[model samples]
Target chain A: MPLVDSVLAQYFEDALKRADAMAPDYALLWQSLQAATYGGKRLRPALVLSAYAGLGGPDPAEAAEVAAAFELLHTALVLHDDVIDRDFKRRGVPNLAGAYRSRAAGRGVPLEEAAHRGQSAAVIAGDLALTGAYRLVAASDLPGELRLRLLEELDAAVFASAGGEQLDVEFSLPGRRPSLQEVLQMSRLKTAVYSFEAPLRAGALLAGAAGREVEAVGTAGRYIGTAYQLVDDLLGMFGDEELTGKSNVGDLAEGKCTPLIAYARLCPEWQELAGLLGGTPSAAEVRRARNLLEECGARGYVEDLVECYAARARAVLAEAALPAALLAELDGLLERAVQRSR
Target chain B: MPLVDSVLAQYFEDALKRADAMAPDYALLWQSLQAATYGGKRLRPALVLSAYAGLGGPDPAEAAEVAAAFELLHTALVLHDDVIDRDFKRRGVPNLAGAYRSRAAGRGVPLEEAAHRGQSAAVIAGDLALTGAYRLVAASDLPGELRLRLLEELDAAVFASAGGEQLDVEFSLPGRRPSLQEVLQMSRLKTAVYSFEAPLRAGALLAGAAGREVEAVGTAGRYIGTAYQLVDDLLGMFGDEELTGKSNVGDLAEGKCTPLIAYARLCPEWQELAGLLGGTPSAAEVRRARNLLEECGARGYVEDLVECYAARARAVLAEAALPAALLAELDGLLERAVQRSR
Candidate 1:
């Protein structure tokens, strides 16, 4: 883990060595970004390494740049995710954009323009990290063909995510909701593949793993990623805000098309809270929305979905006959991924 | 030109063929995007093909896909440019983001939230186009090494542009302003390299041109691109809305970091007007701001700067000793690039 941290740190120092040459403020932005990633879980990077090591490859150290690439990509997604979701906080603090917004406000910029500037800054920040993700892959010291394939994989994942994102926007519109099955499909396309499948496969591919092993890891990724998102949706409804590093009512306020929301739409009893789903729902309204989710069986439905997918993921890992220790690591991963739901 | 158009059209058809399969609304968004590119100047695509043919390439037809890639890259940059500038119009019409915002507003969505949604949609639209640009290159019929180098060139240009953009934001801050030298550097980094250098060098690179020739084209592109941006900045302040398809007052209202603004910061008489730059200046204030720009000789200063870069670009073209026809074509290109200044 410290090796991962050191690799990321070195990437920042070298990749952004030109930042100071470009401009001091630009350097400051990159410095702040480096700081932001330092204290985080590095989950995506871990997946990349674990998948690499599990597939009978070279040392995990050789996979470091690829791991760093995914971490940067995840950072890009989270930054833009806040812009789309219009949330201001991350990890109980003003996020990257929010920090800039507060800075402008402190400087007496008109509130509207300050907010606009903040969002604009974040967009550029995400763009920087997004392209930096590709640059790292190019710098990965991997074979050229493998590097190209990694880019291709990353592209497919982003393409799927962009599609899912557009669908998400459409579903938020009145009378324009996707079906529950569509929601599940969107969740897989939106979150599962990119969050799980892409990193796992990239790591496997880099290790020169067998096709069967690569395919097996991808299948495992799909199931685990689906479970991960389902649990996340449940947490959005009921998890402690402090624990999740998110507002408990964000999904309700943003009208996110989570599986639970999809199921809630099927229940007549949930109609009243549906109006509050995307609006500025108060704490009391969120509590009532929670009750509606409980009464209408949406919560139970989501929990069952999570369990089903988690079980499928476990089954895939067992049948693949990966190292027993690797299987145990994956088991721990699955448990850690879903345990937040409670 | 028609070949380039057909290539782009076919790409949209096939690439987005699966969009409707992903989500109908996703298909609609791509449809809107395709329409958005239809009426543009096609200058970047032209540069790609022109540079290819001028370099003694066997055929311009082979360059079509790469040409289309540049157009998409331009489109991606412009979409985000609107979001950053908070500009509502493009070519005298509601820009892509503005149109979406209008639609949301028409649906009785609250004005502020609708605006936020519109910007969010634009962010995703840009992201889609950005990734689609890379996908086209991967899908190009060019040799592998050439394609890879093209990506490297593109990566550098985008990296420079991002730095320029961040610097642009920093300079727009009230207490922060770039020197005249910094403004010129930012203009080249922000616009010229991406707009002119990358596309031109891409065409030549695809034609198997040599390193010296390729580097010369980049130098020419810098002069031309900076000149083009200077002319554009002037148009933003002084050109007729009917002629430019943009209000003359937009630069003042947006508080852009144009060379003119850079000069105005030096004039004591322009101090009060500078405060009105980024705010909602009234018509009378805009008129006064214009007067101050002229009175303080900032407008003349920018015109001279444009002429300087334009002449420099012509010199680079002549010195490069490309074919006479290529030089003449570049002469025509240079004229076309900055003619709006008159």
Candidate 2:
């Protein structure tokens, strides 16, 4: 973990230096990106490093670069995700986009113009982070064949995520009606492969693990990652803002059709709550909608779904015949992943 | 050329097939991407192949893959560029984002929501193309070391372009008053490196050309690529829409401060034309602004600048002692690239 942190830090330092030579404005982007890299759970990097060390990878240093790559990839995706969702804040403060927007506003730009500038900055920032991630792997000291293999895996992860993201946008449109099954699939593809499956498998591959073991870890990852997203949905709706660093009403305002919403759609209270979401709902409206969802068992239903996937992940790990250390570590991670309030 | 075309076609065919399995809506995204790939002059790929073959690369097949990779990268950047600029059309037709917007409109979604969906789709589609470009190089039949080197170069190109894009966005903000020198720097960073230098150097590298030769071609590329963008600016203002596949008044509408605008700032007529830009100027206003720019010598100034850069490019190419065939091909490209009315 420390190795990955150092790699990421060094990477940003070099990037910042290069950007400084370009222009002050460009340098600001790198500075903002460095800030965005902080405060993350490092879940993906943890999976990469843990899998590698637990499976007897010879060099933590090599795996560190790969782990750091995953962290960069995560940052890239989150930046773009915010742009798509039109979110300007993360972790209870101004994100890269919001910061740029505020910068513009401070300079007397109109609010709308400032907002557009912020979003455009975000798009460029994300491109940097995304390509930077690949550069890390491509430029690392790893063996050529091994690096190529890892890149292929990374590509598949990104490809699936892009598809998943498009599907998410499609599902969010008013004219489309996505079933709960489709929602779950979107969640898996959008969150699971890159966050968990690819990192886990890459670590295993780097450790010279057998194909069967790599496949097993990837399968386990799919379940655990889906459960993690499900928990995130719960936190988005019910968790305290102080703990979650997100407004509980934000998802309701966006009318995000999470598993909770999907379940609520079939409930008797749907008519009452349906109009409150996917709009600029007030605090009172959000509260009423939450209450209706709870009364209709939607909240309970999503929680049950999380537990089900977590259990399945546990089952896969147990039967995968992984090293004792890795199995225990994964078990601990799974519990914390799904149980976290944020 | 046919080889590159086939590679791209196969790439899209496979991509579309995969998207089809995801969902109908997702598949539509791939369809849009395929359409977006059409009608390009394939300048980047041409540079790659020309450099490779002209330098005596053994296998055109392998270089074709790398060339195709450049095309994908171009498409990726274009998609993101449209999102940043909030443009829905490309080549005089609905682009990936516009197509999605139209789809939503057909389904009775509000115009605003549909536009948002379309933009989000472009973001996702760009991600796919960006990563897919890397995949092409990583998964190519080229030797591992060669592939890794190409990826590193590609990474540098993307990084520079990202920085350039941010700078462009920054300069467009009301508070920024960039000089002509600064504008030229942005143009070179945003357009020259990825579009010209990288491809030429990459092709030479693939062909195992000497470092000095690669460096020479890269220098040539910087000049030519910058000149190409200058021509694009001229087309954005003076060229007919039917010929250019873009609105002639778009640059004025966006208030983009190109080198011409930078020069115009010092002219007597600037005050008369300034307010007409960076706002939604009416057609008459656009005409008046155009007249003012021409009267102020900004248009002729940019044209002279293009000739200056193109001449420098020709000098470098002539002195580089490149193979006769590649040199002739590059000269022909430079002429068409800078002189095209479109």
Best by TM-score: 2
Worst 10 residues of 2 chain B by lDDT: B333-342
Highest DockQ: which candidate? 2
Candidate 1 C-alpha error for residue B45, in Å: 2.3
The stretch of ten residues in a row with the least summed lDDT in candidate 1 chain B is B131-140
Q: What are the chain B TM-scores of all models?
A: 0.95, 0.95
Report lDDT (Cα) of residue B236, candidate 2.
Answer: 88
For candidate 1, report its TM-score: 0.93
Candidate 2, after superposition: displacement of residue B120 in Å?
0.5
Model 2 complex DockQ against the native:
0.71
Deviating ranges (above 4 Å) for candidate 2 = none
TM-score of each: 0.93, 0.96
Q: Write the per-residue lDDT of candidate 1 for residues B207-274, one digit (tens) a residue.
A: 89888889888789888888899998988888888877777887787788888988998998666866
Candidate 2 lDDT by residue in tens digits, A1-342:
689889999999998888899898888899898888875889889899888988899788879988998999999999999999989988778889999999988888899879878888888888888887877777777777788889877877787788788888888776567999999989888899999999999999889898888988899999989998999999989988877777888888888989899889888899998889876887888889889989999998998988999999998998889999999998887888887843
Worst 10 residues of 1 chain A by lDDT: A135-144
Tell me how far the alpha carbon of residue A233 in candidate 2 is from the true structure, in angstroms, after superposition.
1.2
